[model samples]
Target: MSDLPRLSSSRVPTPFIAFAVLAILSLALAGCDGQAQEEAKPERPVLTIKVHYAPQTPDRSFVGTIRPRIETDVGFRVPGKVAKRLVEVGQVVDVGQPLALLDDADLKLQAEQADAELRAANGVLAQAQAAENRAAELRRKGWSTDAQMDQAKAAAAEARGRVIRAERSVELTKNNLSYATLRADARGVVMATAAEPGQVVASGQGVVRIARVAEKEAVVAVPETLVARAQGGEAHVSLWSEPGKTYAAKLREFAPVADAATRTYLAKFSIPAADDAVKLGMTATLTLAEPASERVARVPLSAVFNQGHGPSVFVADAATGKVELRPVTVKSYETRDAVIADGVKDGENIVALGVHKLDTAQKVRVVSSLSF
Candidate 1:
């Protein structure tokens, strides 16, 4: 009977042991489940992108030339033959500098003839005065009639008027002779000469072209696509001779019509109070900062994952350190950047590369950040 009690007690202990073993097995299975779940969730190092809405800068490398604002064509004021070309092309001239002379032989002859006429007129006036004085004395002596005295007075007055007219003719001849010489009307550089020595030129005929150096400007031919941007944005100029230096420029004017030969718009930019370094015909380059057509954010191409649905990017939340798939509208694409129109906000971080293999609830460690 004592052995039976002991066997029964042993059997009871076996049930407790079995219960403990079951409890241990359940705890082990729970631990394995927790480990599997942790393994299933991926934690990969990913490259990230931050949303940005920066105004794009337009590239302006158009070739240009420095030119004077006023290019005047100067010519002679009198009709005559060019006796001499005093100034050559590229020669600087001051106002009233003699440029050329006409043949003065005929002018001299006309002056001489005027002088001879004046001398003859004076002699006639003296004879008329002597006759008038003699006639007045005869009238006083009662031997000369009133009609004869009056006629002598009229002749004297006519002779005196002729003398005055002759003097005026002499003055006019002197002025005509002075007009034979062509002179510069303004201070400027002679760009071109049209008349040569001994060439007959009429009045107001263009003999030389003068470029006024008072104000300078940069002239460039802009492509049709860039004309609007050129006018709207700020323009800068740099001379090829002094590549390191730069000059600020303003949009002065633009040609209304396109150039037929070049098929480009001619734009002129004025340099305010430019120094002497900027010379006429100097080669230069023009740069402009253009505004974007639409304000948008830019992202990398690798960050986008379409998968038949609209394009989406995996954006990482800074607070949670977790990634969320965000739906974005791409405005346009570049070689390395994608212009996002509506999907992302500025300053938001996004996955830059390897977006296709990512899960919606995946936790990621940002290895590096990229700016696009």
Candidate 2:
């Protein structure tokens, strides 16, 4: 006992040891085999969807801004330094309301000069009339030669022409003086102010922006593909604040060319019955709900499986419990779905998910049905 090494097991025969090791290995392998068989036995479970009939609604919705049917830039008719801004931005103005004033010291001086010229012309004309009358009287009395009478007549005619010119000059000077005061030409709300007091502006350079409140228009940008439909389709406008109320709108105008950066066409729609709540610059939703361009089916994006054999979906046979990869014509791809224009009619079952691992001969147990 003192010289021998200790042992954990009793000394056994070689044949008995080999037999025990074999039996343990066989049991371990059998357990693994049983697990693998269990894992591979059941049919693959998949999610599917049954196609159903639905009346399509073609909606082309765009976010747009509410604008006025008539908006114009108001400016001075004559160039001058602005003396005073008579009205501020956001002020409601009526027709002929003075908006701003230009420095009119020079204009007044011009008017006075024109008046003086008119007076001088009138004096000369009066003198010429007196001379022409005397010359005619003398000719009638045979006391003046025809040559002298003709000369007097020519002088009177020239004086009369100068008077006419002076009168026109006076009228023009008066008009220029009145133009110094910029006035509103229509009833509107001032939206913007460009010129301030003491600023010089050229003739017809806008100093204020006014929007006429007679009618409201919804202005939106349409993509190139929907340009024609937006121009022809029935449009409805609703404010972001007031989602429940919608106003009927008609297409008033559309840009012939697309924007260079966005490739969108600007469109304007007239709202005939817009109330006071439809304010300028308010955000609105412009929906172009045209009749269904063509009846078609739309399915979830996951249902499509394109694996080098073109785009297809695994269509399931409910009676046979098997699936087949059927080709489909995809019209368009949306954010969450694809529009199917030519394939997969109503009342057909198709695999909605897990199409990557499915084969035509393999049977799939339907776990759930999804709605598109």
Candidate 3:
């Protein structure tokens, strides 16, 4: 007993030692719990965009072709073999310019025949007139009967009718001979030629295709949904070769029916300010600008969040640095963005990415895309 060492005053007893250990353990456990709580409520950094509202003047563009306002297919008025094609494709021609010539041998022969028939009719008339004069002179001497005088008058009248018909035949043949040449009715550029030097074409067959360059137009196929808007909207045209230059265009014609295959309406927009540079068959872009439409917010597509309820977005509070899942009315989705029709006020910060991991009232650090 004596040999056992007495505990010093500076040393604690077993109970106190055990109590101290327990208290230290409790403090350590509380500290760990507090640290875990702090770590769990982390400040998540997210990319965000500022919301801005503007009148959606949606401009729709369509590929089109520059064309002429009036295109006509001219052909010869008389049937004959094509002798020569005077104009080639892309040749500029004026009104009354000969485009093609037909073989005029047949036409010339018919005219000669008509002239010979007229001469014969004139000779017969002369003979009849001389015979009638002789008959009248005999009747005056009382040597001619009344029947003979009547017969002479009828013969002269019939010969005069034959001469009148022959003269009309000569005029018809001359007109037909003039029709052997195909002429341009309007000043334009020739687009195509169907008749070669030796092709035989009937009357009214397309021999040459000419497009009037006085007025140019942009032709495009518009979707059925935008037909009405396109007609009332202002149009502008730009050529692929000259993108910087734009010509004001006006809607001139719209097809009443939709095309069967494409389900689109054919629209022709006249370019009153079109210059010579706007050539036929050039690729063009037609843009239609609508009047000020409804105001909407366009947000990045990744900012939209959906969890079986509808489309919503996480809007960050500027003051609290917290995010709130907001229900938004999405009007439409485009290639890279979604158009928000409503439920988002102007000048709000919206989380632009990582919306799936966000929750209501979650604290976040709003970072701009430019910061990167």
Candidate 4:
């Protein structure tokens, strides 16, 4: 013991040290294997939807304005400076009611001139008739030549024709004078005024826009895609002022062509039961329910996944519990859902959320809607 090195209490045996190192290395290796296995595991369960196809009767809504069945621009029949405007925008007018007045000074002068001419013609006719009677008496007495009597008779006839022409002129002038006062052709409401007092307007130029209130209609711009639908669909109108009430409507008129700027068709729906509450120019909502033309399924927007390969969704197999990426043809997108036209059949399960994180042909557990 004195010659050899003494064993220290803190010193460990070589065999024991080797065994401890081996045990620690084995434990570390085992931990790494477990972590790798965990990382390689399949994804958790995903929310899904079981699609059901049915007749697709989409409802299309459009913002429109309440209008009249007959709206026309009314103007004076005679050209003149506007002396006064009797009706304003939004004024209710009856048939024959004066809407505006033109300056009648020239018209009055014309009427007076016509009347004077007619009076002069009458005087000339009276003088010619007396002369013709005298010539006939003289001829009958053999004191006047036949030529003189014939000339007198011709003069009388000419005077009578002149009088007739003058009378017609007088009537025409009177009509023109009356035309200077623009009158309403029908009972309507004034929508707009184009001519003001003292403004010169040509004959037939619009002075006021009148809308007949006997029948009501809704004028709306429909999307080109929905033009056919609007023509044959059922329509309902709701006024912005009276939201609680809705009136049934029928398609009255639809434009054959689309507007140049908006590429939309102009459509008018007639409301037979409209009342006073449905005033002209009021805001209205027109909803058209299209007939079912095809079979389709509605799915959530989140279910659709697009990765530069158009649109696709993950569908889970019922037997294998595995998901397969399926390409879907989306017909249209709604507020919170999408209408699928093709590429998937009825009774197929589709992943709803977290679509971007999934891979094709992966296994997933199906979760209920409440748990999700």
Question: Candidate 4 local accuracy as lDDT?
Answer: 0.90
lDDT of 2: 0.88
Candidate 2 lDDT, 4-121, residue by residue in tens: 9876557766898899999999999999999999777777888888876443566768999999989899898899999999888788899999999999999999999999999999
Whole-model lDDT, model 3: 0.90
Which digits, one per residue and each the tens of the lDDT, describe model 3 over residues 9-74? 678777988899999999999999999997788788888888887658768999999999999998
Model 3 residue pairs with clashes: none
Error of 3 at 50 (Å): 18
338, model 3: CA deviation in Å? 17
Instruction: Give, for candidate 1, the lowest lDDT window spanning 10 residues.
Output: 2-11
State the C-alpha lDDT per candidate: 0.86, 0.88, 0.90, 0.90
Q: Residue 40, candidate 4: how far off, in angstroms?
A: 55
For model 4, how does the per-residue alpha-carbon lDDT over 137-182 read when each residue is reduced to its tens digit?
9999999998999999999999999999999999999999999989
Off by over 4 Å in 1: 1-55, 112-172, 291-372
User: How many pairs collide in each candidate, listed in order?
Assistant: 0, 0, 0, 0
Residue-pair clashes, model 4? 0
How close is each model in CA RMSD to the real structure?
Answer: 8.8, 15.7, 11.7, 14.5
| Tens digits of lDDT, candidate 1, 1-372 | 656634555566677888999999999999999999988875777888777786555357789999999998777666888888888988988989998788888889999999999999999999999999999999999999999999999999999999999999999899989888877777779999999988998888988899888789999999998987788987789999999988988989999999999899998999886788999999999888764546677787898889898899998876676898889988789998888887778888899878888887778888877666
